[model samples]
Target: MIPPATAPLFLEQAGWPHAAIVPLAGDASFRRYFRVIEGGRRAVLMDAPPPTEDPRPFIAIAEHLCQQGFAAPAILARDLNEGLVLIEDFGDLRLKEYLEDQPGEELAVYARAIDLLADLHQRPVADVPPYDRAVYLREAGLLTEWYAPATGLVVDAPAYVAAWEAVLPLVEQGSAPVVTVLRDYHAENIMLIDRPEAKGFNAHGLGLLDFQDALAGHPAYDLVSLLQDARRDVPAETEAAMLAHYKAVATPGADFDAAYAILGAQRNAKIIGIFTRLWKRDGKARYLSYMPRMWGLLERDLAHPALAPVADWFAANIPADKRHDALVAFAPE
Candidate 1:
């Protein structure tokens, strides 16, 4: 629901009336989206309230993507002070929904997504923070901070940090040349843009969303986000094929496999902690249901030889049987 204090200002800025606005589903962030219809014209009103989040990064990133010839939404109007921006509506067809409706087209859809990433990797990082080891270590630390408490386990913080420190350098050494990494490049954040004449595998057929948290980092990070998605299950064969396709096109070095696995494990580990925090701190329990899937992904990534130290940490701290939903595992009877 739009805040009563900001509703009038948002409507006035978008030229939308009370009757023409319909709420849209929001993601994990504090941003709220609404579909505004005025005179049969449709646009999306993004209300990202102040203090918690600012719309400046999103606005800048969207413009950057558009300039790069990608299918990012155009900003129709904006009020940074009010934390509102009216943007082009990409319609209701997110890539995840499209795949759900047309399961047969999964491979093709993912192929296009991978191709988009290939194109993105060719561009140098723009105005964004670097995804360095400090960032990686801090993010991965969430697992120990949140998940441990949620599961009634006490992890040795110094040992956990040491384990990650050992693995992160290998990840950096093995990754492809640095590029703008869309921190959350999963299926849910992708859209299938309608562009029939879009040429080549690296064209603008795919739409990008939820890139406000984008960073300058290894290319393998986003690939991991896509193939080893948290909210959805991607087949092992499909993931393998997509990885091969990316390798052929992008020509990343042989070290790409090790980097992908290390980054995948890092990402999944952060997600486990984030999900647990969502349930305990934000009171969002639905994220708990995805924990088992996330654990499976983490386990797979940990199997890589590069992740031996972090893998050992997980094995010692979180037993396989105990790595289920922390809420359920530690719930009061």
Candidate 2:
């Protein structure tokens, strides 16, 4: 629900006092979104209450994307003091939902999505925080901190950091030019839009959402996020084709295959911990359903020889049999 103080302020800023407000699905953050309709016009009100959530990064990223000719929501009005922004509504057809409804078109849609990435990567990195070793270690640490405790296991934090230190350098070897890595660039955050005549590789056919956490990082990080998605399964063939397409278009010298695997392992590890935290700390048990799929992806990434140290850490700590959902194991029977 929108905060009592925020509702009046949002309506005043948006000039939609009588607009019927309908709550939309929210994300993993403290933000709430509402669809505002008045006189047949529609817009989205993003209620990101301050101290816990801020709208500045979202506004900056949206403007940067728009400047690059991409399809990000336009900010119509905003009250940053109250953490409310009125922005363009892209309607209800998310790529994940659309793919579920039309499985046959998954390849075409994903191809376009890859094309969008290719276009974005070709541009210079936007001004955002670097997704470096420190970030990797901090994010991957969530596994040991949250997932370990939620299960009946103890982790050596110093050793965990040491293992990651040995493994993360592989991602930087033969690195490509850093691009604006939309940290959560996956199917769920992508929207399907109608723009048949949009030109070039960075066509605006796909509407971007949930990019407030973007960073200046290796291009492969976002690729792994897209292919080895936690919330949905992308077909292996599609992943292969997209990877090949990206390699063909991207600048040379980067070992994309190895980087993909290394970063894939890193990302999956962080997600496993994030999902566990969501369940144990936030009481969002639904996230636990994705663990099996995440484990499968993590296992695939660990198969790469570059991830031997981190993989060994996982094998020693989280045995294969114990990699199942913690929520189910710890549930009161």
Candidate 3:
């Protein structure tokens, strides 16, 4: 993750000329983050270089989340030409690390996250793209696009699309009172903030990040993202309890279970393709370590009755040895 060459200059123009820049992190996309520190002040520089990535969605989403009294990072400065934005920094602590260090807090921490989602779903939807059928097909198609080729399988792509078409209407039924779904509302992306946060929504120091891809989607989408996390192993009991907690806290649609299960399968399948692509195309092998976990999550989602078509697609196409068990023994060249 090379620091973008324009970073120093951007910081200088953003009024942090003398600030020290340290690499913070990079995600699945073309974006990169750096922590800029000067004296006692600090901010995160998001270098979302153009031609591949844009920072506008992230900026707009952050503002929207703030206007709604949620905990997205505050954008301080920007330079559109270089695709750089200086924003408030939520230091190193993330829910994944904190919970790993204190496993007992899993239920409580997850309950808070679920509470935030409940609050969010109750608010007005953000002015963003709708998570419609095209988006669903494109995402679910990743499994065939990347993972299938990587594993040397000839997937029935048309059948896969047909399967999704069959079940996606069920998904639409559960999107009642649609809200902005933060597409990556998982453990690692959620920061445990040390500063005072917004009062409403039970944000309670949970600093949101990586929401540039937020979409006007089903209420269950974010919940599925949180509980069926690919990177973190959320306990089954904790997942179940938090889900019940969400139902108690929010007014979910009658088909919320079907919607949740479908989204879970879709998201987990997307992640499997993504992680596989990160290895085969991007040459990032570390993501491969999370594949088994993703497969496990995907299977759990597949068991739900609503996912029969998609589930059947997987069973007919991705054989068991070529699935999670095979992935466990697989490695990139």
Candidate 4:
């Protein structure tokens, strides 16, 4: 992961020319990251090339989150034309890995995240794209478009759309007074900071990342993302406890429960397809390992009465036996 040729000049202009740029781990995007060390301090340099990705949304949302007093990374420098940005470093303690080492802290750490969402919902909605019905349907369509065909199944596309058509109105109705929905809010995107001196700076003691895809949508969306995370196993008891915690603290609209179930199913379906696409198209086989978890979570969500139609659609199109990777991963590509 070599930094771009102009990277040195950019760092130099940002006053870190001689800084040692150490490559950092990357995510499921065209973006790459580096830790620029200078003056005994560190900053993250994001290289998000254009046409496939945009750095503007990230910059805008980051500034907004900072203004609202959340722990989003502080933007230190930017070169939008080159799709590069320098931001404050939030160490290597990702919430997922941290919780893996300290399983006892899962409940408490998730409580802080839920509490942060409650506080965020209370603030004004940011200027962002709407997570509208069309967007929801398009996201869910990834399953039919990518996963189903890859699995050698002829899933009924029309039936799939019809199922969502019946359930999404409930989502639209419940998502009143829209707020910022951090579309990727999960254990992986959060960093646990040890800010002993400035703990008050982030009351939750969590650092947020990869939130450029924020949307104005139902508050329950992010909760589902965190609780039903495909990357890690959030224990069933912990999930139940966190749901109760969020409801008690947020006291959202009456339809929160229904929306949570609906969105959870939708999110899991999208993730399943995305993981398949990663393997089939991007040649990223590692994502395939997450499919089983996504399927398990989707099945759990489908148990909700609110998602009856979508559940029926899945049951009819993709049998329980074919709801996983076995049929697809080995299928003729």
Query: Quick one: best lDDT, which candidate?
Result: 4
- What is candidate 3's local distance difference test score? 0.86
User: Model 2 over residues 1-333: C-alpha lDDT tens digits?
Assistant: 654366765776568878777888677888988888889788888988898999999999998998898988888889888888988888788899999999999888888888888889888678999888889999988888888887778767787788889977767664577789998999899987685532211455789999999998788888898989898989999899888887887763467687889889889989989988877877777788888889889899898888888788888887766786545654433
Query: For model 3, what is the alpha-carbon lDDT of residue 192?
Result: 84
**How many clashes in each structure?**
0, 0, 0, 0
lDDT of 2 at 205: 78
Task: Tell me, by TM-score, which candidate is best.
Answer: 4
Order the candidates by lDDT, highest first.
Answer: 4, 3, 1, 2
- After superposing candidate 2 on the true structure, give the runs of residues whose Cα lies further than 4 Å from its correct spot: 2-4, 195-202, 329-333
Show the colliding residue pairs in model 1. Answer: none
Using TM-score as the yardstick, the better of models 1 and 4 is 4
Higher-lDDT candidate of 1 and 4: 4
Candidate 2: residue pairs that collide: none
Looking at model 1, which ten-residue stretch has the lowest summed lDDT? 195-204
TM-score of each: 0.93, 0.94, 0.95, 0.96
Task: Tell me the lDDT of model 1 at 101.
Answer: 92
- Candidate 4 lDDT, 51-100, residue by residue in tens: 78899999999999989998888888999989999998888999999988
After superposition on all C-alphas, the RMSD of every candidate to the true structure, in Å, is: 2.8, 2.5, 2.1, 2.1
Question: Which segments of candidate 4 are over 4 A away from where they belong?
Answer: 174-176, 196-200, 327-333
Task: Please report, in order, the local distance difference test score of every candidate based on alpha carbons.
Answer: 0.83, 0.83, 0.86, 0.88
